[model samples]
Target: MKSVLITGASSGIGLQLASDYLENGYRVLACGLDVVKLKAVLSHPNVTHYAFDTTSVEQIDQALGQLSAPDLIILNAGNCEYVNDAQQLDAALFERVMSTNVMGTVNCLSVLLPRMQAGSHVAIVSSSVTWLPLTRAEAYGASKAALDYLARTLAIDLQDASIDVSLIRPGFVDTPLTRLNDFPMPAKISVTDASSRIRRGLERRQRVIDFPFLFILVLRIFSWLPVSWWQSIAASMRRHSL
Candidate 1:
């Protein structure tokens, strides 16, 4: 069976993806911060549970070192914390978000890439928030924006190595994380739907996979407008939430 390794398999999209992949007959390497929680959520003979703090390089090395690379690797682990008061400039908040979303992924790649065989596929889960800035998403949006660039650049650099890179830009997935949002979420999709879309895209080896068509289309349209115009729209959205 083809093996698939996924980070953040404890919950949300990661959990759903793991379950889906297992059902499809792929050997699963499920990585999470807590082994107990991961096993509680996912228990199967074909599934191997790996516990490691993605933000800690040493932990990742200790857990993943010496293991042969899987056929597919999805760097889906991330943290989402909003900067409610952008004016206050929360350096610590930015650090926490970036540490997990950006640097954490980087830390994984540092170890996993060398072990990956040719023809393997790697997918990066980036948010559609990168397409257009939203209110109070300073840290989360910025981190995903960085992933967008990183994934695209990796696609170009890893081409000769025969390693396919997929950049997944999901609009609003209705996972446990989104349930905590105080603002309205337009076109939010369930975790199952999100997993199906992602699996279809990966099977096709598509360079860019964006979902919930209408939502992404709206963002693309607004992105075409002048900065001032979008800024007005964003301000209106903030007002509506208030």
Candidate 2:
């Protein structure tokens, strides 16, 4: 069987994808911070579970050091925390989000890239929030924005080596991550739908997999607007959400 490894496999979309991939007959290497949770969620004969904080490269290296490379690697682990007050500019909050969502991915990539070879695929979970600015998403949006560029650049650089990179950008996936939102989430999709679409896209080796067409279409349309115009729209949303 082809092998697939997924980070953030303890809960949310990660757990869902791990389950679905295992069902589809892939040997799964599940990674997360919680050992017990990973063990309980992916308790299959073909699934191997590892626990390590994503932010620490040492821990990641230690965890992945001895493993044979999986044919597919999904770097889906991330954290989401909003900036409640932009005027205050919470450095700590920004760092917390960046460390997990940005540096954490980088930490994993540092060790994992060598294991990827020809015919290997790597998918990174970025957010649709990167399509346009959102109210109170300074930290979250910026982190995903970084991933957007990282994935695209990797695609270009890795092409000659025959390694494929896919950027997974979802609009309001209804996972545990989105449950923390206080404002209304338009066009939220269930984890199952999210997993199905993502799998189909990866199988095709699509460079970008954006879900819930209508929602992303709206964002794409607004993305073409003048900066000032979009800023006005964002300000309006901030007022309503606040």
Candidate 3:
């Protein structure tokens, strides 16, 4: 049976994916910060649980040292915090988001990459927020944007090693994370739907897998608009929010 390792397996999309993969007969290495939560979801015989904070490099290294090389590694652990008042500029909030989303992924990569072989694949969970500037997403969007670039660059660099990289950009999946959002989320999908789409995309080995067709289409269109136009729109939105 093929093996896969998923970070953030305690809840949301990660939990769903871990369950689905177990059902499909793959051995799963489930990593999450919450030991209780991680154990609750990973009850299957094929699933092994590792409790480690993604923000801690030492923790990631120790956890990874105990596992064998996985055929697929999903670096999906991340947190999102908005800049509610950009004028105030919450540097702490920005640091927290970047530490978890960007540095967290890097920490996992440092430990996981060396163990992966030529046929192994790495999937980075970015967000569709990177497609356009959105209100209150200053920190969250910037982090995912960095991840998008990192995944693309890894794709190019890992080509010679035959290690495929897949970038997953989901449009608001209805997970615990999004449950905290105060704004309306268009085309919000269930965790099951998100996991299904992501697995299918991985099977096809697509470079980019963006979900909810219409949502992605809209974002892509907006991304094509002139920079000044989007800037004006963003500024107007910021003012309205104030």
Candidate 4:
């Protein structure tokens, strides 16, 4: 049976994807920082729980050392922290977000890429925030933008190697993390729908898997607008959100 390894499998899209993959007859390696949470969420004959801090390269190497590479690897582990005041930059917050979202994926890839057989697929969970600047997303958006670039670059470099890299840029999904949002979220989808979209995208081996047609479309359109126009709109949005 083909096996898939997913980080951040304890909650949100990662958790949903793990369950969906298990039902589809794939051996699931559910990796999360919290072993107890992983066990509590998933219990299956073909599912194995791996606990490791994705921010730590040593921990990732040690944890994944014993297991052969899986057919698919989804680097979905990430954290979100908004910059409440852009005027007052928070270096610590930026570090925390970057360490988890960007470096965390890099750390995993550093270990897994070598062991992965050719034809294995890797998906990195970036955010739709990269499409257009949003209010209070300073740190979060920057990290995901880095991921977007990283994933695109990897796709080019790994194409000849027979490995595929998918950049998943998801809009708002109804998960615990997004529930904390105080602002409006247009076209937000359920976790089940999000998982289904991601699975279908991966099956087709799409290089960039962005989601929820209307929402992403709007962002794409807005991104094409004049910079000053978008800045004014974004500033207006910030005013209303407060």
TM-score of each: 0.99, 0.98, 0.96, 0.99
- For model 4 the TM-score comes to 0.99
Each prediction's Cα lDDT score?
A: 0.94, 0.93, 0.92, 0.95
**Model with the higher TM-score, candidate 2 or 3:** 2
Question: Arrange candidates by TM-score, highest first: which order?
Answer: 4, 1, 2, 3
Worst 10 residues of 1 by lDDT: 78-87
Please give the lDDT score at residue 159 for candidate 2: 91
Estimate, for each residue in 126-171, the C-alpha lDDT of model 1 and write its tens digit.
Answer: 9999998899888999899999999999999998899999999998
Which ranges in model 2 have alpha carbons more than 4 Å from their true place? none
Tens-digit per-residue lDDT, 47-76, candidate 4: 999999999999998899868999999999
Most accurate candidate by lDDT: 4
Tens digits of per-residue lDDT for model 3, 1-242: 99999999999999999999999999999999988888876798898899899899999888787567899999999998888676899899999999999999999998888878998999999999999999889899999999999999999999998999999999999999999877668899999999999999999999999998999998888789999998898788767656
User: Which residue pairs collide, candidate 1?
Assistant: none
Deviating ranges (above 4 Å) for candidate 4 = none
What does candidate 2's lDDT look like per residue over 115-221, in tens digits? 78899999999989999999999999999999999999999999998999999999888888889899999999999999999999999999999988999999999
For model 4 the local lDDT of residue 75 reads 98
Q: Poorest 10 consecutive residues of model 2 by lDDT? A: 108-117
Provide the clash count, candidate 2: 0
User: Positional deviation of 184 in candidate 1, in angstroms?
Assistant: 0.5
Worst 10 residues of 3 by lDDT: 233-242
